[model samples]
Target: MAQAGTAKQPNILFITVDQMRFDCLSIAGHPIVETPNLDELARTGVRFDRAYTATPSCIPARAAIFTGQSPAHHGRTGYEDCVPWRYEETMPGELAKAGYHTQCVGKMHVYPARSLLGFHNVVMHDGYLHHNRMRHNVAAKDHFDQVDDYLVWLRQQVPSADLVDLGLDCNASTVARPWELPERLHPTNWVVSESIDFLRRRDPSKPFFLWMSFVRPHPPFDPPQAFLDLYKDAEIPEPPVGDWAMQEDPMQLGLNPVTDKGLVPKRRLKQAMAAYYALITHLDHQIGRFLQVLNEYGEMNNTIIIFTSDHGEMLGDHHMFRKAVPYEGSARIPFILNDPGNRLGLKRGAVRNEVIELRDIMPTVLDAAGARIPDAVDGRSILELARAGSASPDRQQDASLDSAVQGWRPHLHGEHAYGHLSNHWLTNGKEKYIWFSQTGQEQYFNLEKDPLELHNAVNDAEYADCIVHWRQQLIEELKAREEGYSDGEQLIAGIAPRSTLSFLKA
Candidate 1:
């Protein structure tokens, strides 16, 4: 019999896309992108309109998904390398211990590159790692030969094939062009192909967890020629320019991170966005193919499907390019949960507006598998919030978890350690207050009135009190962190917080 308080184990299919914007789907009212397959998922399940990545960067955001802990608790405050992940508690570790066959098909960006967390096996393909592939490193030449499964297959398919032959830079977020290679050979297609192959090779008796992570809608902006043609004549809207974005050239402003998008040309932005949207459409079609395979195998009935992103790209919003800042373009993400068997009693196609975070993924997966969440976990299970009368016997961590499940997530704190202009944000889904920790500049936006963040009302008399309240809230939040961001009353900038917590042993 299944353990008490645990429902029958259901197959969990968690899908993630890297650096995708929130409004890229047709269902989300996007003007250009048409993601019919993703829209179908939203139509059949619950879509969260206010989901966020607590730490809006690659490594920190992914760590929250794995450990069920906030960036501060997990000890990875920002993007870092060689930070050994030795956590005894992890999402897959808990699920694997509960007898589920967990496997990750793509993009496990963990240090050591091949660390499985707790997965029994992984068909590895993390798109790019600047740290591992450093030209000066001794193992640089042999890096792919030793660690990359996708590259091995690519070479076998076409011995002369090179990622550079397509004239794309994996790290550059600038250009947009039609994919020079065949559609079937694209990285996005390869991830789906491998995931389908896994379903064919799995042990049918055990409930399974599959992570199909995609690397596109990210950089180099190359979609297959057909997808590009689909949007070639579409009327893509101009990006909503902010009141403060008249002169965005970070070069002119002397911004420390020179890669800032303040000065990108108008023509380039249009091409980049066009290609970005096409990639989403292509990705959506691949997902549709994946779903068709699952249906053919008769596994969709009992499986719980989830779709989300690691973090959002700015996509030229507010004159920003990549993540690491606290704007909605960089922090907000798409979160959809399709419970095919209606295990949670949540109304189908319901739009849940409560604030959600990536940290919540671990406990939610554990709860689905009849596995107990540990006291060390800081994230709450969304399922706990949907069902009533679920309370913990212990009140210590229960108090924190209740806030989310009970719809009491009044505030979510976020930050990033950029070189010259570090920033932090506090939001309640309806409004936002941003603080430039280094420069002491503040930006306030009422998302209810201005979803585009066109105006900054920090100095407006109408919102002076609202600004004061969020500022104090930030002060209290930083007091809880080890960074010493504030005194009891006021913020104290310039105290550098360590990337990895000192307590974490390698």
Candidate 2:
């Protein structure tokens, strides 16, 4: 007989979908995509509509999630075009030590994409897919242009020369679909297959922490024939602010390079959005299969299932096709948590509007699994929200938690190091402030009325006090991080370069 007090330790099924935006799901109210599995998952779990990625790119966002630290502190500034070889503390490292069988499959985007970080097993997958250093030549780069190892394996199935016409395109193609070509393989399918294989052979005695990541609905918009056909008659909604010519923001004005149509005409926007949604629907179908396997093995009831994306794809929103902007379309990411224990007595189907970030995920997972959370994990766990009705349960802490000054932090900060120098943001409650170092431009928005953030109130004299407060928040936050460093600690943490450390110490 199971003791009532002996807490049931739930297995964690952590799935990360690359570049999936917040509004891409059918349940999230996307007008085009048919995401049945994601919809179902949303129905049974908490949907964090306002969850933001601390950094909205590949390597930096991933490092933040794994290590539970802000990118400013992690030192993975941006997508550096190479593998990050640094051994940093990771969530799986704590879980693995605590006896969970940790495994990672698919695109982690962490340099190498093969770093164990903390996972006991890692099935290395795609790293740099969209980037091409070569100038285009008349000869089309054949089947294996990106993700070299994957293309090499595809060649073993058929002669490389035979699959030459099926060359991979890193950029989304409006002219053609690569499916008819023989060597093209969907990265999402490869991730799902790897996950299924691992689950098939997983030991039943020990619980598991599986980080199943998929790279799709990311770009190159190459969804298979079946999924594309499924959305043939579907109506894709025109975004509320699709026309860039009418926009006032300089960021919006400067993003003319993202569109496949060069200038985004309304008709082309609809077609492109439909194609992106089709890829999302296809990704959802694969997730459905993975979930089905868990259910068949009776692991569903004992698993703490989490589904989220690293960041978001603009999909032509704000006239930008890809991410790396401070707009809500690129900054906000989807976050969902479905713990079976919540099914019995805890609150299920909850929606949290409170602001959170990607860094919070590491501590949250560790809290649920009863794993040791390293002191280095700066983000606080949201397990309190599941264990108790509120994120902060005690009367004293709950008061503050429910009020804006609670739970692991009173305010959160974000930074984007690549692109135009950098953009740093800080927000608490309904007030948000952004600062771009390159342009020395500052913007402020009261999210209460201006959720879309169309109007910039930075120059307004009336809101000067509010701007000052948020600016202080950002400065104080950065200063706090700076204070955490010491001569000895900085050297051991590898924060100071070898040459600089020696000179400074001397």
Q: Pick the candidate with the highest lDDT.
A: 1
TM-score of each: 0.92, 0.81
Compared with the true structure, model 1 gives a TM-score of: 0.92
Tens-place lDDT digits, model 1, residues 1-506: 24522336888899999998777778888877899999999888878888899788888888999999987788877777667778888888888888788899888888777788999888887776766666577644336556778877888888967566666677455567898878999889999999999999997878888999988877768899999998877777776778966554535431322244665666766777788889989999999999999989988877888899999988777667788888888899999888777776545665666787999888887877778898988887887554332232432233334554554567788777775557888888889999887778889999989998999999999999999999999998887776778887898877775666677644
Q: Model 1 Cα displacement at 473 (Å)?
A: 1.0
Q: After superposition, how far is residue 485 of candidate 2 from its true place, in Å?
A: 17
